[model samples]
Target: MTATPPLSAQVAVVTGAARGVGAALARNLARRGAKVALVGLEPEELKAVAAQCGPDATAWEADVTDVEALTGLAERIKAHYGRIDTVVANAGIALGGPLLDSDHRAFSRVIEVNLLGSVATARAFLPALAESRGYLLQIASLAALTPAPLMSAYCASKSGVEAFAHAIRAEVAHQGVKVGVGYLSWTDTDMVRGADEDAVLKQMRSRLPWPANKTYPLEPAVDRLAAGIARRSAHVYAQAWLRGMQPVRWVLPSLIAAVGSRDVARLAPRLAATAASRLRPVGAGGAADTAARSDRSDRD
Candidate 1:
């Protein structure tokens, strides 16, 4: 018998594939012989990423927060691919600033896109995934493991998704469909680079202890994620150290509270000065999300 190729029969869908981790992960999956569906808000960037993923890959422009669009897109993907093996709910945005000084719209937008968006993606694709007995990987962040002072919205959204994925994992197991939560630290992605552009945000992150303070390269991180997808791991850690964080997660909030307050106090003046400008989401992906929302509002 001819040997089967790796992931040769797999069909994977990744949201937020326009740039950063999502783009890189899509390419990784494609390289492993999986047909990839790239979904995101940025059409041009998504097209470029799809081209890079070879002929078997295609791009779809849709907001993760839009249920109707995602539902339709999911059906279209199933029709095109004949079977869906994996779905990566990786769409997310972040804004950094004290809650009192933050843009209320931006803060709420983060929660909607990061938390509710993942839920919508699951709802849209779970049927297809169940039919194939495939996997769904929900991309969460270290923010879910440990909260920081200025990242209230991000932390809350990530934490919610982590819980959401865990709850559904049990619910879907009987159907032979697997659910996994992916945890990434500060990888050198657009979002992290964008956060570094602000002085106060940069300094605050720099003060994080040991390995957590470091920014890791993207390729190695995506490699781990791809490996996790192959195994359908319950918890995928982009950084090895992140796996070690699970046991200590319960104590992290209290530790951050005790230590972070001092840092926040020292940075208060600078934060106050830059709060207005920093109220919006960070990075190119974030910019695209903001513009997409604005365009939709105008159309409405």
Candidate 2:
């Protein structure tokens, strides 16, 4: 394998840095000598992550959906670091259930955070990235390429961000800004565990194809992400198999639909009943009880 460039004295801003993939990524970046700024809503958790990341790492609490707050954070980090070298718009949320059974408010909120929030992060950090000829990494999901039932909002948001990243790449490449989109299968993250807590959802996911059904360990994925960022990769896949899936993406949706149709048909009623009470948006904290709660309106 080729060696990654050193990140000593470079500045990296990672949203959703309190836990899960975000937390791990920040630490990994720090190990490579990047001064990381952890941004999320969970103050205590963020502080802990920063502490582990070392003295140069700082915690900045802000909701990804809050455009003004994110913009201010960018300015603050730039002021403190002198220049920003990389940005990882990794903050995202997941909501699952049958469309009819899902809360419209929660559905909108997912899009607001996972999709628009990524856009805001990119917009907020673009100037600094451009100035330094830096890299921007958007964390998407396998859901973006392979749509799943009972996860309408997540599929939509991840799909949107993937497209957003592609479009943004075209716009920013001329300015020497490199853009990358990350695709992950089910990993051992709080978000996956939260979704699995619903028995019906768990059953449905278990029926998925081989590797997709497996929840891979978190460390390997984060390690690859760190390496990808160091190399300014155009696309990053947490699992090696996912790389092959990209070129054949056009046929994946149909294949998944065909295979998943039976599972959805069997679990539809249970999904509706269980999703309303059990499905919580994955956020700052690893699990539902501690995850950030959402308001009824996206305007909030």
Candidate 3:
């Protein structure tokens, strides 16, 4: 009999696989011998990521926010792979600006994609995961732990996913479907780079304390995520220091409020002077999400 690969004969589904953490994680899992299903709105980018994931990988274009599309995609993925041993709900977008000045639609879109989209992903794939006794990893962020100024939408969405994943973990435990929440600090992704383009936003991030302000390399961080997937960890921290923050999480909001308020006050004028258009979603992935929504609206 042929010996199985190190990570097992697993089939993994990754949403937002077109770029950043999602794309990197898909490639890492594929390297470990998992057949990957790459899902996202950018068909061509998803195709490119799928190619990097090798022959056993395939790309599917679908919006994570659309329950019908995701449910159908889940069915097709299960049919194509025969089983889905892992599902990574990593699709998300970020919009950075003061809440008062932010575009209402852009702010809401962040919540829809990052939080509700995660819910939709879980709803669609839980059945397949339960059947395989598989793992579901929800990609949250440092924003979830420490609320920051100018990132209300992103923070709220990440925090929501973290809570949502925790609640479902209890509900689905008997089915043997393990749910894990993955957290990342600032990483060298398109989203981060996009946010850095605006001097005021960049300055606000830089003002953050110590290691939390640093932008980490993507590969090593993703390698840790792959390890977490293998172990089915309850909480996976891309940066080591993040795990330490958990014990003190309850105090973070107060701390951030004290510190971030000063920074926001100092930056407020500059932020207000910045063009309204520049306050929109932060990266190419975010741009694609906006365009796709526009297209959908046009169709409607």
Highest TM-score scorer: 1
Local accuracy of candidate 1 as per-residue lDDT tens digits, 1-300: 222225768999998888888889999999998999999877888899999999999999898888999999999999998988899998887778899998788888888888898999999999998888889999988888889789898889889999999999999988889899999888887667756768888899899999888999989999999999988889999999999999998999899999999999999999999877776765444353445431111000
**How many Å off is the CA of 277 in candidate 3?**
3.4
Over 10-99, each residue of candidate 2 has an lDDT whose tens digit, in order, gives 799998887788888899999988999988877888899999999999998887777888899899999998989899988877776787
Better of 2 and 3 by lDDT: 3
- Is candidate 1 or 2 superior in TM-score? 1
Q: After superposition, how far is residue 41 of candidate 1 from its true place, in Å?
A: 0.7
**Alpha-carbon error at 81 in model 1, in Å?**
0.7
Q: Per-residue lDDT of 193-257 in model 3, one digit per residue for the tens?
A: 76677789888878888988889998998999999998889999998999999999999999988
Lowest lDDT 10-mer window, candidate 3? 291-300
Comparing candidate 1 with candidate 2, which one achieves the higher lDDT?
1
Count of clashes, each model: 0, 0, 0
Task: Give me the runs in candidate 3 sitting further than 4 Å from their true place.
Answer: 1-6, 284-288, 293-300
Off by over 4 Å in 2: 1-5, 278-280, 284-300
Q: Rank the candidates by lDDT, best first.
A: 1, 3, 2
Rank candidates, TM-score, best first: 1, 3, 2
**Model 2: how far residue 148 lies from native, Å:** 0.8
